[model samples]
Target chain A: MQQVFGNKKAIAVFVLPTLILFIVVGFLPIVQSVYYSLLEWDGFGKGKFVGFALYQDLFVNDTYGIKFLNSVWNTFYLAILSVCVQLPFAFFLAHVLARGIKGEKFYRTFFFIPVTISSAVIGLLFLSVLNPNYGVLNIVLDQLGLGSWKHDWLTEDKTALSSIFLPAVWQWVGYYMLLMYAAIKGISEDLFEAAKIDGASGWRMTFSIVIPLIAPIIKVCVIFAVIGSLKFFDLTFIMTNGAPQPATDVPSTLMYNAIFRRNMYGYGSVMAVFMVLECLLVYFALQRLFRSREEEVAR
Target chain B: MISALRTKWSNVVLQFFLIAFAVVQLYPLVWLVLTSFKTNLEITGSNVIGLPSKWMFENYKYVWVGSDLARNFANSLWYTAITVVASGLLASMVSYAVTRMKWKLSKLVLLIIMSGLMIPVHATLLPLFIILRDVHLLNTPWALIVPYTVNAIPTAMFILVGFFSALPRELEEASVVDGCSIYQVFFRIMLPLVKPALVSISIFTFLSAWNELMFANTFINKSSLMTITVAINSLRGLHTTEYGPIAAGMVIATLPTILMYIFLSDKVQKSIVAGAIKG
Candidate 1:
């Protein structure tokens, strides 16, 4: 039985299809993206090799006036908000719900409904609600005597990017909440019982016991939020399509426009490559940051 | 007495907060449903938040029958179905091999597959587009199918591996000692034991494939081959200010998953949590 199961051929047969597909569809494309980033081509014609000029143009030149750096900044801006605002809100909800609140199941399901729905649908839902002319938001604001605060949420450059962040944060707070809630639920009840017997205040108990124990899951949620923000495309694409002079452009949308719209495959590939590297760098930095803090806590 | 009063007050406040937050979370969807039933005049009226004075069901009929939504719906259904089954089976096999089978390179193989999770789909668009064009699958459902299955493998495997690793070894050993072949042991004995994980992975994959927009938008240009997402996106482009049919289109696109979540919320939540912690 061991011999048959351990046969080299059997192992290859089982594992190779997925591995090959992963390489072909996942790994090779990334390597090819890097290679393509180094060339000048229209994606169909014969390419001429230009060394790192595209990367420099991405940073320095405004030849296309696409604001590559602005898109990068926008992506990071969303990532920061995700980490700061979304994570805390999610964590707070999870922390509260983990106390075995009544109708916890109902609340959990209700909150996560948005997560299951497609981003495109959510984008449309919000677009209708935020439309400048007939949007419910501006109408409500007028009734509440806050009409001065209303503007073209998706059109005007001042509010377009910030407007998108609301839906972005809305869609996923419940998702991260569920993650942290699950982690918190896994904590042993005995610790809470002991803390109660010791007369620990509820706030103190949560701050010290619950928060510390769920720190690892919190890190996971942070990484998810950061990466999710970096790759945020669907909502922005469907909602605004990077309109009003690229005000709400993220890297993924920028990459899409470059390749598909402008036929600048090399420039698009550079954005893709940059996204991959940024994700890796942020992931490792997060790991190191969390690991060092864990060590400090242990000491 | 003061402490007890404080507890009661806090509980009321907390409940209010939770309920309020839930309202904020769900109001947009409720508004969407209501607006879908309203006339364009009603939607564009000064009273944007009011119930439709007359619920018009024609918007739904227009969206369902007037457009290519029905065909696109079929495309989304079949694409998601194929992706879920193929990816689930492949991922389960690889997971079983990596977790149970004693192979020297199992860890490396697992690493290679799992690393696919980090590569954003956008990064692969250009080359994928070119490859599909070369293979004459640019407008075919296969373009979406192949990438969907490939990209879904990591998350599916991540869930399956945890389940596979936790399965008791005695059952496999007993089956083997009874002259059952390795294939029989796997197919007949092992696969059923991990049904829960497989179900969760299928749900996750189905939701993702159903919601997939970028690939569908990029690869499939013809209205005949467009998924519901891409189809609805086109609908948006054509009917930019036509709120009723547009809202109806979104409801059509979103209803299946929303209903699925309603029934299988537990399994979905468990899968998400398990995938997060384990992956």
Candidate 2:
């Protein structure tokens, strides 16, 4: 068995299919995108090579009227909300629920339901609920005498991007909660017992013991949230499709519009390449940031 | 005495808060189901939260027959089934080779596969579209299936690697000493050992493929070839004022996932947690 398994041919036979598929369907596209980004083509009948002009136009010049910089900034705004607001709220719920509360299974299942369903479904659900005239949100607000606060959530430029975050947070809070909850649950009971015997209060135990121990998982959740937000397209696509003049445009949706709608394939590939690089850079930067903080804590 | 009393009061308050949050989390789904049963007049009327005075079960029938939902549902089912099986088998095989077999480039191979996780779908969309168009696979189910399987390889391999590595080596050694071929050892002996992991990863893969929208939206242009996600999205444009049919469409699109959660919630939750920490 060792001889057969260790044979070079056997290894190639086992691994080559996956590797080749990954390269073709997964890796090759990005390489092709990078290559395409350098050329000037409209996705068909193209043979011109104008190197770096597309990238220059994307950043310095607004020749294409793509709003590329604004889309990047919008993506950053969503990523910040994901890390700052979404994950913390998820962490709070996880910390509370990890206390071995009753109906744990029920609550966990319910919380995660949104995570499992299609984002388009969630987007439509909220779109209907937040509709200005007969939507439930405005109706509820009117009954509570806060009708003045109600606005057209997904249409108006000011509220469209922020309004989408409500559904985004609603969709993913359970996901991060489950992650943190699992990490917290892995902490041994003996530590809590030891702290209790040492007369540590509940808040102290949470602050000094639980939070510190789950710091690594917290970092993982943050990375997930940030990366997920940066590439977010489905909900916004369903809700607004970057309507009302690109107010809710993220890089992914913008890339889609450039490629499919406007037939600007080269420009779209530029956005795609930017997104790939941004994800990698953000991931590495986060790893470094988390590692430095861990070292400081150790010191 | 005062502290204990305070603890009890706080627990009550905490429970109230959690329940309220849960209500907020679940109310939209409940409203969706209720609205699916309401008339268009009821939905757009002033009575927002009231129960339907007369149930409109025909909303479901109309949406089902009026759109390509039934065909899209079949497409989604087959696409997910093929993707889960193909990706699972291929990932497990690679993971098995890397972990159990002797190979010098195993670590490099693993790293390459793992890096696939960071490549966003947006980055690959145009090139893939061009390739599929060139291959005449655009507007075909193969377009979705190929990408789905390829993209799922990393996560499936990530999960399977842990399970494959943790299996005791003694069993493999004994199987070898008994004159079993590598294939026999893998197929007859090792495959059954990782059944639980396979099931968990399959569930994850199924859910991902089921909920996927972008690729389905881009690759398959024909209404008949559309997936449930794209089909439901088209409903938004088709029946803008008809909330009842739209709600019914959502319920249809969401039912499979809801059922999976009901039956396999624990496995699903555990696998998700494991994948997150391990990945």
Candidate 3:
């Protein structure tokens, strides 16, 4: 203990700056936000203290109630849909590429390029491409004699959600696929050669041998996917601006709107607090579920 | 013979399906590049997928001269480079001490640094804004650069720590014995060994800092201080629209990033695939 404590000077010199910066810039806001949740501050005025009433109203009021519910739904939508839509294809493609499939590098780059672009840019690009009349998608439909398939994808209620969801899936499928590909390569090659000699077919081999061996990575990917799902913004905000009413609002957008646009600092803080808590809940739930699944598979 | 042909046909079908999915993924980007050449009216008119009848490179011309996008791009570039260097070195220093030095407080410091990862950027915005304001950093480069470097420390440290942990102890010990102080050992011996991890963290740090919107939106006020993402978003007012210059601005904002990704494409693929396990 004494010997460990002897290096206090070295430790303090290394750690103090980041610690101090995080304390002032990060932690204090969380504490202040909780405190602000009890007050009525419109960003810049002296106001009365309103304790927990804001919380009660945010939870119970019918006007904001549906919006809040929709926000939660949007979170779940991105989390669940993206994982389901992206993972199966990403895993197979990754497996093929990792095993030195033809043109592997080009395929990987094509998929992963979207991940590098800002979500804001992707949102804008898609908005133009999905424009009801002049958009490229509609043009494609016309060329193919399937004009009926075309719609104002972003603005119309029937297609707005899918429009945003599809773009998110498109931009990121490569990113996750790359991660999966890496994990696949890391798996020992001797195992695969052994499986081939045992007369196991490729399809069965992938499901049982490959999937179970890389389960840990897939678990981490899901956790990362879940958090990303719940907190996504940029696309919905810039693409539609919660347009056609509250059709595409997520919690982050709602929190941002409440704080900046509506000038409801206290109310916004409550939403912000809930968002943090909601993320934790989803994260742990997935972790527990996956961890147990691993144990079950092991047993 | 008929059955054999059927089996061969099935393999081709499966391969084609994978190729089709890859095509769909790459299309939106192809769309982005093509639309940048079309006129505003042309883009907004019929035939979203049709070929541009007349390519007006004017969009690029208008976006470059008409707005503050060029300045914003420069700001993002400057911030990304400065933050990557500052935070990268700072993280390496901290990781060196924590992993090599015999200190109880170093572990505590490591824990605090790691915790910064889970603290959402939004949660930090308000307090950080006030802190920047207090320091007279509002609308200044300090607001963007300082907050960015501070935010990047955790991930930089985490990667570097993981790197330094996996290093053999004998080399570091030999450096210490060769009349090298801790600082010399860190710089001369330990630093050169962790190049891959450092590059990986640096790319991620630079990318996040360059592309972030909320923090830039909240803390920065001067139009001069705007980033590429922020300036592009602000082009249109609440009522009036300016799609032409906006798309142009979007393309300009995109070029640097595309260039960086292209040049470092192999490095990025290597970085992420290397299984950077922590933040």
Candidate 4:
């Protein structure tokens, strides 16, 4: 025991692989992104230290500043809309499915199918399906009496970003449901029986009993959702390509296009740095708020 | 009795709603498979709504060759293999070291490792690019391999540490008394035991690398070197967009994941359940 107790070298050996990778890839890049933010470089061109000049470019100029605003707004807008819609729907639907409600296995498997499919595939399918003239959606609307509701969803500035949200929500809801449902399922059945004896209706039982118990899980779920949405990339990129002339841009797409296309790597790094801060702020704030709320509830 | 019948009818209605949802969940993938058989003119002129008239396996063949998805799959397979083995081993090691062993300094080490999960790549892409450039790892497999492995540590370590901590330590201590080294105790003992955790780590790493994009998109600019997701995204740009080849490529791309899911559905479901279990 004494021999093993002081074996720091062996312990370090065990820890070395991951720790080194963390430093090389994870830790260093963060410090480097901030450093790069202070310079002017076009990747191939020489970098000049401008001392926060790129930030000046970000705020003073309409070009970068406005694009950043559109991106941030779209990201959070999608996040808010997703939480409001997906959570309650997944919660209730999970409750319904969890009740040994016939075809239970089928329903569970059914919802989870989309999750195995990648966001890229979902984006591709929607891009094709939401085609303005010949798409399935517009065609169905034209068949109905509400032909006036027909509009170009993906290409329109007003609807493009929001248009991608449905597909994102569709792919994700089941994944979250599986999380929430699994949580609800783990709750003891005696509670449900007790609620029934108290004359609680199904909806009431769900609201009072299941909701409170799963609140912690839901908090984590919402955190995952919000942080994920804040940094969302692939689906938006593929689906809209920031179409309708930059109206649909999210921060990631902005960061990507800035770096890849224009080669304005320095200004792009500033935007990237801000994105990191925004996520940290949102995450810490949510966590702090949730912690306090839990304490209050306990009291 | 009437109320009982009404309740049964409502349950049936709910079942029907769920079945319809299952179909809607499936419709796009169904279309992709069916349309792979359709001709270019068939896809373009006809609505992308239904089954194909003829079964054509050639779309798969053409895409495998023409779009170079076979090469992309090869790249993805290697990426998945390295990431799963290397990351899983490293994460499992740290998990054992921190969780089971009594080390005062390990408390901080564990916290640092777990907190790494909060670091999203978009936050650090610029810096990562510079670091990779400085090391000349840009456009190399090392660029993808190192970062993907690092990014996975927290989640995989979190899962494994929970699992290892829950393990009864009596057997391990007995092995220690029998003059077994830690390596043998882990390999001859705990390694075989944590099969499920290993599976969980491997599958998670496989899926993560298999679906990885942002880094690959930024780093690997070479045509032959792109991973499948990047390859698929670039497929449209590499040539004219032909529905057959695109559908074929998607089919090829999707098969490995589907096969893995089919074989490991129970294990995968268990992992998700385990995720919910701890929370």
Candidate 5:
């Protein structure tokens, strides 16, 4: 059995193909992007080495820097809102649903529908809903005697970025809810029974029991939300394409414009490198944050 | 008796809250479907959110024929189908080897594959674009299929590894004792046992490939090669006033997944829960 299982050729056949593909597509590009970020290439001509010059531009050059920072802020804003706003709402929904309400399964399943559909479809759907003239939103606002509230949601800079976030947040509320819901559901019922027998109410049980128990999952959810926001592109790309350019841009839309649209391969690669490092940084930071806290709880 | 009455009243309130939020979650989709069949005039005029006076089934006809939507739909289907198969096969092989095989480097290999999940898709776009271009895969089906399959592999491996790890060692040992070759053991014995994992992984791989837009938009410039998401986005730009057909396009793009979910919600839900727990 050990001989068969350890057959070198069989192991090679099984692992080599996947390993090669993963490295070429999944792993190599990241290394390539880091190398490319240091060059000044238009993706056609010979690349000139300019170590950290583009990075300087990304950080301080007025035109590019301002736009890059704004996009970063926009993404971070979404991250903040996702963690602060969306997760809580999802947790509330999860908490209520986990309490075994009527139609609990139905609600759990239905809420996740937005997540399954493509962001492009959701973006287009919201575009129609937020269209200033014929949009359902403005029309509804008019009917509600709030006509003054109507603005060009996709066009106006003040409203554009936030408008994009609505659909972005809306789509994933169910997702994080489901994650937390599953975690909450996994808690042994005996604990809940004991708490109830001690005369704890639902809210008290949630705070003292559910919240503490599912804290790790909630932390995971936060990392997901933040990382998701950091990389979010499809909806913003679909809805605005950074219409109020620089205002509505996220790092991804900017990276896209730099590479595909403008042929600034080097510049774009810098943005790409920045994003990858940023994601890694945040991921490690969060893991460290969560791990320390878990140790504290254990202590 | 009074406390029981209060509990009943609170349960009603909770039910009401859940129902209300459900409407919020589902109404936009329902509205999109309704708007799909409505005349553009009605959509922009007297019936923004109500039933259309004239249900224009022709809208579907227009989007399907007047553009490359049918071709795009075919491309999306072709890409998604190939991706699902390729990722599932590759992932299963990797999972089986890492879990069952007694190899020294299996741990390192699994770690390498799993780390693929951490790199955001956009982070790799520039280099991937260059790589594809250099290989002359740009504007071809391989451009999207290769990337989509590669992207899905890590998650597919993550899911399949658990299933593969849980299987008893005796099954493989018995198969080997019966004179089955390693390939035979994997193909005949191991593959059939993990069919449920394959199904869940396929559902996930299918959804990502089907809904993918950035790569589809960037890589494929030829109208014939574009996928449904790009086609729908283009329709919105080209036929701005023709809301009916655009809505129809959105519906067509969305219908497969919605219908799929309705049929396989249990598997879909489990797959998602499983995927998220990996983090």
Candidate 6:
């Protein structure tokens, strides 16, 4: 069996092409990014080794540092809202839908619709929906006799950040809901029956029974939400291009402008490196935090 | 009786909330489709949320004829097709080798490949630009296809490996004993067994490659080679306030995905779950 299954030529034929492609296209660029992050150069021509000055500018220079840090903060803000606001709402929906209501599948089918559509389309959809003069939002506000509530959603600094992010956050609520719904559904009916017999209400079952049972999956969702927030680009680019630069800019958009627009390749690579590290750091830190909590629960 | 009444009332509220939330999730696509049919005047004036007074079929005609969107749509279809097929085939081969075939470095190779999931694709953009430029592949469709297919490998393998690992060893062994070669057993037997996994992963790969924007935008400078997302963006650039035509282009770009979901919601949902599991 080993001889037949492990034909050397066959294994090479099966694996080598994918391995080489992954290395060249997927892995090599990451290594090159790390190398470029250490230099000071435009995208074209020769690059000079600058020994982390580019990275220092991201942290210490007034113009670059301020914008970069603000971008980082905005990205973190997204993660915070996704966990605090979006996930909880998804949980609520998943909890209600898990109770075997009529049209449960019907509701779920619609809820997941936005997830299938492109972020570009979603961005454009929200762009028009928030188009100030003719937008549905302002028109509705007017109909409700609250004309003062209307503002240029994507143009104003105050609303632009939150407004652009609303669609991004909204797109994935169904996703996390579906994940948590599946996790909650995996809980045995006997446990729920026991809770109900003890006179525990639906809210009580949710807090005491469902939350604890699905804690691991919830932790995974939180991590996913955070890392995904750190990588957000398309919608931000489409809606505003991080206009009012440091105000609404997230990391990817900032990096895009730095490298692609301004030819600041080295500084841009610093942002890129920072993003990759940020994702990894958050992922491991969350794992450690979740693991420790699990241990505490065991005790 | 009073407790039962409380339960029934709460259920009604819950149902109402679910319906409202579903409408919120679904309303924008509804709006986009409706906005596509309206004239610019109707869209901007009296009918932001109602049926168009004059349904303008010209918007679709404009997108289909007036711009390079038709050519761009063809490019998108061609690129997405190749990506789906290539990623599917390559992922299956790798998954089979690692899970079924005995190899010394299989585990290590799988680890390196799966790690690609964590490395955000955007981080590689600068370096990829340099690499592709040096190789003279910057403006070609291969620029997007190569990276898209490669980026997809990790998620595809993550799905396929589980299915491949679950097949009983004796099934393959029996085929081997019948004098079938390893290649034949893999291609003729094992591959067929994992067709369901292949279908789900292919759907996911198709959706992602179709909707990809940044790489398509940055790598392919020529408008002729641009995908629908880039084309639509350029269209938006050229016609800033022509919401009717822009909306029509968006509708055309999103129609395939929406239609596919209507037909295969279960498969789409399952594939999304499979993709998210990698996270």
For residues B31-135, write the lDDT of model 1, one tens digit per residue: 989988988888888447988888889999999998899999999999999999999999988999999999888999898888887878888999999888988
lDDT score, candidate 4, position A252: 86
Model 5 lDDT per residue over A157-256, tens place: 7999999999989999999999889999999999999999999987899998999899978988999999999998999898888888777899899899
Candidate 1 chain A weakest lDDT stretch, 10 residues? A1-10
- TM per candidate comes to 0.98, 0.98, 0.93, 0.95, 0.98, 0.98
Task: Give the higher-DockQ candidate: 1 or 2.
Answer: 2
Could you say which candidate leads in lDDT?
5
lDDT per residue as tens, model 5, B1-279: 999999999998888888888898999999999999998778988788898788899999999999999999998999999999999999999899999999899999999999998989898888888889898999999999999999999999999999999999999999899999999999999999999999999998888899999999989989899999999999877898899999999999998899899999989988888876676
TM-score for candidate 2, please give it.
0.98
lDDT measured at residue B118 in model 1 versus the true structure, 0 to 100: 80
Model 5 error, position B52 (Å)? 0.7
Which pairs of residues collide in candidate 6? none
Interface RMSD of each: 1.3, 1.2, 2.9, 2.0, 1.0, 1.2
Which ten residues in a row are the worst by lDDT in model 1 chain B?
B270-279
**What is the per-residue lDDT of model 1 for residues A1-299, given as tens digits with 9 covering 90 to 100?**
67967967777888888888888888899889999999988888877899899998888886778898888889889999999999999989998888888878888889888899898888888887888988889988988999999998989999999888889899899999999999999999999999999999889999889999999999899888888888889988988878886798888998998899998999899999999998889888988999999999999
The lDDT per prediction is 0.89, 0.89, 0.77, 0.79, 0.91, 0.89
Docking class of 2: high
Docking quality of model 4: it rates as medium
Q: Which stretches of candidate 5 lie over 4 Å from their true place?
A: A63-66
Model 4 chain B: worst 10 consecutive residues (lDDT sum): B270-279
Candidate 5 chain A worst ten-residue window by lDDT: A58-67
Off by over 4 Å in 1: none
Residue-level lDDT of model 3, residues B1-279, one tens digit each, is 996898678657756876787778777777666666766666677434556678767777777766777788888899889998988888888888888778656777788778776666666565566667778888888788888898888878877888898999888777666666666667788898998888988888877787787777777867788888888877765213556567667777777767878999988777665434552
TM-score of chain B taken alone, every candidate: 0.97, 0.97, 0.91, 0.95, 0.98, 0.97
The superposed Cα distance between candidate 5 and the true structure at residue B106, in angstroms, equals 0.9
Can you give the DockQ of every candidate in the order shown? Answer: 0.76, 0.81, 0.50, 0.58, 0.83, 0.78
